[model samples]
Target: MTERLTYYLLRGLFGLLARLPWVFVHGLCHVFAFLIGRIVGYRRAVIRANLSRSFPEKSLEELRQIERGFYLQFAYNFISTPKLLHQSPERITSEHFIMPDLTPLEEAAKSYDCVLLALGHYGNWELFSTGQLLLSTIGYSMDQVYRPLKNKALDRLFAEQRQRFGARLVAKDKIARHIVEYVRAQDGRHWLVAMITDQAPGIGHATYFTDFLHQPTAVLDGIERLGRKYHLPIFYFDIERRSPIQFVGRYVPLYDPKEGDLPNYTITERYARLMEANIQRDPAAWLWSHKRWKRPLEHYPNAVRSARLQALLDSAKDN
Candidate 1:
C-alpha cells in the first residue's frame, strides 16, 4: 500500500512538472548538472579520462567541452524523463521524431522470425523505444531486452513507461528463452528483439575488445551470438537528435541471416562502428557518464588489447 501510494505520488509530481515550460525544465537541468558535476568529482574525472582516451587527437580544451556538454545532456535526459512518461503517442510522434526508412527493417522482420535490433544510448533511447512501439502498432511485435534496475519501485515505474507503447519488456536474465519463444510463436509475422549493444557486459560474459572512439573497449557479444544462433536478421538503429524536442531515426543493415556464417565479433564490430560514427557526429548526445569501461585494469586493461580479450580471441582461433 505504501509503495503504491509512493508510486502515484511520484507520477503526480512528474505530471505536474511536465506542465512546466521547456526552457524552465532545461534551465533546471543546467543547474542540476553544475551542482552534481561538482559533487561527483570522480564521475566527472572518469568522463574526462574517457573523453581523452576516446579522442586523443582532440585538444584538452575540446575534450573539456565535450565533457561539459555530456553532463548537461545527461542532466537534461534525466529532467525530461517525466515529460516523456506523460507524453502521448500522438504528441511524441508529432513532436520531433522522424523515421526516414523503416521499410528495410520491416522487410527483414517479415522474413526472419527474430531480428536483433541494435541501438545505443545515443539521443533519447526512450524515444527510440517509443518509436519502436509506434512501428509495432502498425504491425510488429517488439520484445525489448532491458537490464534490471536495482530499485524495484523505479524499475516497476520504468517498466510501465516502456510498455506504454505496447513493446514487451523482457528482463535481461529471461531474454534468451523469452526471445526464442517469442520468435517461435510469432513464426513469420515480424518480431523485433531490441538490444542496446553499447553497454559493457558484466564480468565473465563473452566480450570483445574493439576500436571504439579510438580506444580499445570491451563490448557485449550476446546480440551477435543470439542473432547467429537463431538465424535472425541484424539491423542498426541510429538515433539522431535534430533538436531538444525532435529526433531522426536512421536504419542501416548490418547482417542478413541467409548470408554465410558471419563471426559474432564481426557483427558487433560493425554495430560498434555505426555507434562510434553517431557519437562522433554529435559527441554530447551519447551517454558519456556511464562507467562503460568498468572492468578492473587487471581484467581489461586500457592497453591495445586487454589480456582477457586477447585470451578470448586466441581461444576462439584455436577452436
Candidate 2:
C-alpha cells in the first residue's frame, strides 16, 4: 500500500513536470543537477574514477571538466524522461527528437529479416521510444531490451513511460527467448531489437574483453551472439544533443560477420570501438556515473585475458 501511494505521488509529480514548457523543464533540470551534485551526490565518486581511468592521459583539471559536464548531462536525461511521459507523439518529435537521415536505419530494416541496434546511454535516448515515426513507417516494430530497476514502483513507472509510444519492452535476461516468441507471433513482420548495452556485465558474465576508453574493459556478448544466431543486421546509434532540449540521432551500420571463422566477438569489439569513438567525440554525453568496471581484471582468477588486462590496468592506474 505504501509503495502504491508513493508510486502515485511520484507519477502525479512527474505528470505535472511533463506539462511544463520545455524551457521550464530544462530549468528544473538544473535544479536536479544541484540536487544530484550537492545533495544526492549520486555516484560522483564513481564518475570520477571512471573518467580518470578512461582517460589516463588527461590531467585532473580536464577530468574534472568532463565530470561537471556529465552531471548536467545526467540531469537533463533525468528530467527529460518525465518530460516525455505526458507528451504526445507529435509534441515529442517536434520538440525533443530530430533524426536527419533515417535512410540508414530504414535501409537496414529492409535489407535484413530482423534488425538489431545497440546504443550507449547518450543524450536523451529515451526520446528514441516516443519519437519513432521513421521507424514505424519502415514497417519495423520496436522491441527494446532493458534491465529492470530494483524498485518495483519506479520500475513500473519507467516501463510505462517507455511503452507510451508503443515500444515492446522485454527484460534483459529474457530478451533472447522473448525475441524468438515475438517474431513467431509477428508471422512475418520484422522487428527491431534495440538495447542500451554499455553497462559492465556482472562478475564472470562479461565474455568479451577489449580496450575501450583507454582501459581493458569487459563487454557483454549478447548482441553479437544474437546477431549471428538470427543472421540479423546490426547498427549503432550516436545520439547527440543539437540544442537546448533538442537532440539528433546518427546511425552507423556495424560489422556483420561471415559464416566462416574469424576473430572471436568481432561484432562486439566493433560496437565497443564505435561506442568508444562516440564517447571521445563528446566525453560529457555518455554515461559516466555507472561503475563500468565492477569486476575489473583483478577479479577473474586463472584467466588468460585477465592477466593481460591486469597489466594494462596497472599501467593506466599508475599514470
Candidate 3:
C-alpha cells in the first residue's frame, strides 16, 4: 500500500512537471543547478578532484568553469527526465532528440541477431531512450541493461519511464539469462543491447584496468565478454548535445567478428578511447561526480593489464 501510494505521488509530480513549458523547465533546472553546485556544493570535492585530474593541463579557472557546467548538466539531466515523462514521441524525435543516421546500425542489425552498443554517463542519457523508435524502424529493439535501484518504488518509477517507449529493460544480473532465453525463443526480432560502460566497477569485479582520463581506470568486461561469446557486432553510441534540450546520436562501428579475430580487451580499449575523446570534446557533459578512480589497482587481485598499458604505466612511474 505504501509503495503504491509513493509511486502514484511521484508519478503525479512528474506529470505536473511535464505539463510545464520547456522555458520554465529550463529555468527550474538552472535554479536547481545553482542550489546544488553553489549553495549545497553537493559532491563538490569529488567533482573537483575528478575534473582536476582528468585535465591536469587546464588552469584552476578553466576547471572551475567545467565544474559549474557539470552541475548544470547534471541538474538538467535529472530534472528534464521528469519533464519528458509525458512528452510526445513525435516532439521528442523531431525537436529534442535527433538520430541522424540509422544506416550503420540498420546494416549491422540485418547481418547479426543482435548488436552490442557501449555508452557512457555522458549527456542526458535518459533522453536516449527516445531512440527506441529509431531502432524499431530498423527492425531492432533497444534493450538497455541497468542496475536496479534499491528502493522498490523509485525503481518501479524509473522502470516505467525508461520503458515508456517500446524499449525493453534488462536487469544487469539477468542479462545473460535474458539473452539466452531471447535466442532460444527463436523470435525473428533482433535486439540492440545498450550497456552504459563508464561506471567504475566494484572491487574484485574490476577485471580490466586501462588508461582513461589520465587515470588508471577500471572498466567492466561484461560487454566485451558477451559480444565475443555471441559474435555480435559492437558499436560505440556517441551522444552530442546540440542545446540544453536537444541532442544528436551517432553510431561508430567498433568491431565485427565476421571481419577477423579480435585481440583480447580490444573492444573495451577502443570504447574507452572513444569515450575519452568524446569527453575531451565536451568536458562538462561527462559525469564528473562519479568516484571513477576511487578504487586502487591493488584492491582488485584478479585485474588484468595489457602489456602496452603496463609499459605506459611504467614510463609514467619512472618519469
Candidate 1 regions with alpha-carbon error over 4 angstroms: 1-6, 38-42, 186-188, 296-319
TM-score of each: 0.87, 0.89, 0.95
> What's the TM for model 1?
0.87
- Clash numbers, per candidate: 2, 0, 0
Writing each residue's lDDT as its tens digit, candidate 2 over 141-230 gives 888888888888888888888887788788887888866775467465767889888988886676667778877788877887888776
RMSD, one per candidate, in order: 4.7, 2.9, 1.6
User: Please, what are the lDDT tens digits per residue for candidate 3 over residues 1-319?
Assistant: 9988998999888887888898988999999999999999999999999999899999999999999898999988888887774667788887778888989987876777788899999888888788897788878888999999987889998888889888889889888887776666656788888999999887567888887877778888788888888777889988888776788889999889886777788888988899999999989999999888999776876788866568768998899
Model 2 ranges off by over 4 Å:
182-186, 257-261, 301-319
User: Which candidate leads the pack in lDDT?
Assistant: 3
Clashing pairs in 3: none
Cα error of candidate 2 at position 225, Å: 0.6
For 1-319, candidate 1 gives per-residue lDDT tens digits of: 8777877887776677678877888788888878777666538767887788778899999987877777777777777767765677777776756776778876775576667789998877776667764676546778888987876667777788788777789887888897778667855566778889888777776346865775557777788888888788888988887765578887788888778876447887788788889999989788887888777434744334545446655675799
Number of clashing residue pairs, candidate 1? 2
Residue pairs in candidate 2 whose N, alpha carbon or C atoms collide under 3 angstroms: none
